[model samples]
Target: MSHFTQLRTKITELEHLVAALADVGYATVETHDEARPLRGYQGDRRRQRAHVIVRRQHVGAASNDLGFERQEDGTFRAWISEYDVRELGAGWLGRVEARYAYHATRATLARQGFSVAREETDRDGTVRLVLTRQATGF
Candidate 1:
């Protein structure tokens, strides 16, 4: 499969893997949200809300199992599943889940103020993109 295709495929797999783990006890499912367009807009306007769940281990309802830290240009990157893994339970799936988390994070960040500058496949067929931070309040 192509790099982007591979990434996308792996991303889809990880999405399920995350939930499966939560179901089996590999990890606790935190926030699982589906982002979709809610209203009319100039473009494809959409949003995502948290879908909270657990692996029968946690006592309280929590948020997304992922964590994102903003880069210098405002692009947020993270292997958030790994974060939750330590607190919960994660294995090889952590790495894959991280990809899905990143995609969701990128979208959410862009709406908050960060904008993706470019996205292209690398020489090795790997995908990469740039996101910049602009004064979105203005």
Candidate 2:
């Protein structure tokens, strides 16, 4: 494939991963140090293997609703917000926080939707997975 196609595929794979995360009640991202203390979930720092991270019900000054950005320092950021969350969060994502991420990614990927083939709930109550994609007519 061409370079652009490869890049698009990579992006879609990453988006799919994130959308799958949203289907549950969690995401895989981090926030700025300044924004960190504001979170309700000051989650465990140990054993998180992260490249791109998710932030639900958390936002920043320059954030776009359900925004995606890559820092020069190489962190991938993804999120859902109050406004967009209500529109996309659904089905498995039954909570307010989950719904926000669902709706946010839904609009961001009009032609594509997320997939959840597997969900493993750890002893710590964290869900890890290998997500795919699907086409929903709703």
Candidate 3:
């Protein structure tokens, strides 16, 4: 028996979520306007609307489907089978979120003509990113 688990996330933009997934090596395919149920092993399914479907190839042999649903509040939530969580490790969400943040921040800064000046990761898993913009003298 497979049950759909709701993994709450702070991702509002679908592009950011997709980028995050790609960053983590999950190939995603965009679905249509209507939400489709994610099929699972043993005929388990969820009647949820998923904007993007993360292909099952990442989880080989399992019928577990992973997708993202948009909430009324505009944030997106992860809809995945419980089996995937167990197989993909409990830190899956964290890893995705970290990537999302990384991409989002980089995009935001790039739009403002800022580039990464320095990047470093500490022993405590803290990342320090320094941004810089070209100086234009009037």
RMSD of each: 17.2, 15.8, 2.3
Residue 64 C-alpha lDDT in model 1: 27
Question: lDDT tens string, model 1, 1-138?
Answer: 001000112333334444444544446554434322221112222231223333222422332233222234533233322234444454434444544455556667777888888878667535577878875464
lDDT tens per residue, model 2, 19-69: 555555345444232323212123323222224344434433332223334
- Give the lowest summed-lDDT range of ten residues in model 3: 40-49
Question: Best candidate, TM-score-wise?
Answer: 3
Candidate 3: list runs displaced more than 4 Å.
42-45, 121-125, 136-138
Predicted candidate 3, C-alpha RMSD? 2.3
Q: What TM-scores do the predictions have?
A: 0.26, 0.22, 0.84
Task: Give the 10-residue window scoring lowest on summed lDDT in candidate 1.
Answer: 1-10
Model 1: which residue pairs collide?
A: 32-51
Error of 3 at 56 (Å): 2.2
- The model with the greatest lDDT is 3
What's the TM for model 1?
0.26
